[model samples]
Target: MTPSAIPGPIDPPARLLMGPGPISAYPSVLRAMSAPLVGQYDPYMTQLMGETQELYRGVWATSNDATLLVDGTSRAGIEAAIVSLVRPGDRVLVPVFGRFGHLLAEIAERAMAEVHTIETAWGQVFAPSAIEEAIVRVKPTLLALVQGDTSTTMNQPLDEIGAICERHGVLFYSDATASLGGNDFEADAWGLDAATAGLQKCLGGPSGSSPITLSERAVEVIRSRGRIEAGIREDGDASAADFVRSNYFDLGMILDYWGPRRLNHHTEATSMLYAARECARVLLLEGRDAVIERHRVSGAAMLAGVEGLGLTVFGDVAHKMNNVVAVEIPAGVPGDAARAALLEDFGIEIGTSFGPLHGRVWRIGTMGYNAREDAVLTTLAALEQVLRRFGASVPAGGGVDAAADVYRGAA
Candidate 1:
């Protein structure tokens, strides 16, 4: 294409994402991304990487030295941890509650692990004892879990599972992509061996960067099968008899690169590193507990507002995530049409369910930069309008008023 024919200065539409994830990045995060790049091994770049590691340590609530950023999206962190830890035929038990749980099990199977999955209804989480029983029966090498599955808008309680996993000698790993900053996750205190999260949800950034933390045990497992690239091999250097399956997703090599050794792997995603760093900075600045409380308040408003619109909340309300809600689609309203109108007509984006809940529920999120009173109220108000337009009866201004009541109580 000619220079003239090519599009000029890319401009994207202004959107307010009040959906499950990939919401608007915090202003500081975007500005950080726009900063000038530095060379991979440049002192400044490495320094920034080190700083980011420290900040993420706080985000994960861990003192583990393996805290670092994986270059791809949330799934990269997940795959890295699983592939590096699960040797062929190693038993892995996954307790499935929603789509992401099934996803974890799928990844484990592909990694050549003998995977066992115990499942519950989509909108419900398992009791810790049920998982402990499974661990005893399966005698698995690892327990892969999800902290929050946005598909069901449920955040599984991890506080007790970690202890149970510890008792049964199961390595505990959780994907916190949908609940990290806006929810409570104690990586060390909860006995989590490895925890991974993404930038797009509660972290208030884009989806490219994934922050991951590994405990001493988790690091030892990865280090055992560590492999050095052929180009970087030295005379005395050695690799494990069975090296990691995927070169790109290998956590051992990535660890060396992030550590003081500074061994070359892939060139760091520098701009994403900056954004991830700032996301942690801004999050910590607000105080983790305070940020969580904000999500709680805003999510409550969204729930109340939706109920006021005469909609049913899905699943177990007591265990729903603090950032997203799954409301059942009204009987007469077309779920897709309502979502489309919410986007095309109101410039607001909301999410629909996946798998079992598809076409039956709308997954609305109040997370990241969009976790605010106005964002919640606006989404609710707009949703009410769309449903009413689609021939569903909605009480006028009831949604807004109920949301106001929530805010008033929160204040």
Candidate 2:
């Protein structure tokens, strides 16, 4: 296809993104991404990286000096943490509750760890005792888990799990990609050795960069594996590992780039870093508690609205995630068709479930900048219209009314 044969500049239909992540980016974040690029070693660029690290520290609620951006998407952050932390033959325990749990196991396995999992039914979270039992049985060097699983719209309770890992002398790691900024997360207080998140979800930015934080324990593990290959170190210095294995994904080198010495690694993705910095800056200026409360209220409104539409929610309602909700697909209605209609006709986007729940549930998200009153109400109203068009018996205006009532009660 020749360039001239292709379509001309077209405006994307403005969408109300109520899907599972890559949520609508804030205007400031988008603007930041459009800023001019600079050479990687430019002093101003280096200062930008330092500022990004500090901003992420505030978002993550951590004082860990090793915090920085991983050059890929959120999963890159996940892989970097696992591959760097779990050495060959190390034991790692993962509590499987959704698709992302399996992801942690797969990454650990690739890292050559002896991976053990304590799995609960999909849409369910592990009890504190259950996790404690797993830790006792496995005696793992690390415990990896996800704070929120968008596939099931479930938020696993983390505070207790952290304590359990701590008691078992295990290092706890979490993927807070879908939960941070919109929900409660404490790195130091929760005893997390490492936690990685993405800018795309609750941070209101694009997916090119990942924000990661490492505790002292996590840092020690990385440092132990650091080695100056043949000519890289001083003569007679103790030899480290033959090589760090994965070069691009190595957090040790990434840390040095963020550290005072500012060693070389991959050329940082300047635009994405700017976007990440602005996202965190927006969150910090908004106040963490205030942002969390906004998500809570907006999510509550979405849940109430869906229930008022006479649709049953898919997960344990009490343990649902603050940024996303899973609603059962109405009988006789094609799930994909409903989602397409919502997008094409209403200019709204919602997600479907993954794995075993595929085609059985719709995942509606209230995340990042979209977690607002107007977004919630508009989504509910559009959903009602779509469902009614499909002959689903939804009470007219009931969903929006219920959502309004929820907001009023909260106010």
Q: Give me the candidate number with maximum TM-score.
A: 1
Deviating ranges (above 4 Å) for candidate 2: 1-3, 6-10, 228-243
Candidate 1 residue lDDT tens string, 1-411: 888898879788889999999898999999999999999999999999899999998888999999999999999999999999999889999999999998999999999899999999998999998999999999999999999999999999999998998898889999999999999999999999999999999999999999999999999998877465684543235534357789998999899999999998898999999999999999999998899999999999999999999999999999999999999998988889888899999899999989989999999999989999888888888988898899999899989999999999989
Using Cα atoms with residue i matched to residue i, what is each candidate's TM-score against the true structure?
A: 0.97, 0.96
The TM-score obtained by model 2 is: 0.96
- lDDT (tens digit, per residue) of candidate 2 on 1-411: 998899988777788889988789999999988999999989899889889888888888889988889999999999999988888788999999999999999999988889999899987998889888888988999999999989898999888777888777899999999999998999888888999999888888889888999998889888778555434753345544323558888888888878998888778888888899899999999999899999999999999999999999997988898899999999998999999999999999999888899999999999999999999999999999999888899988999999999899988
lDDT of 1 at 310: 90
RMSD of each: 1.8, 2.0
Clashes of each: 0, 0
Q: Which residue pairs clash within candidate 2?
A: none
lDDT of each: 0.92, 0.90
**367, model 1: CA deviation in Å?**
0.3
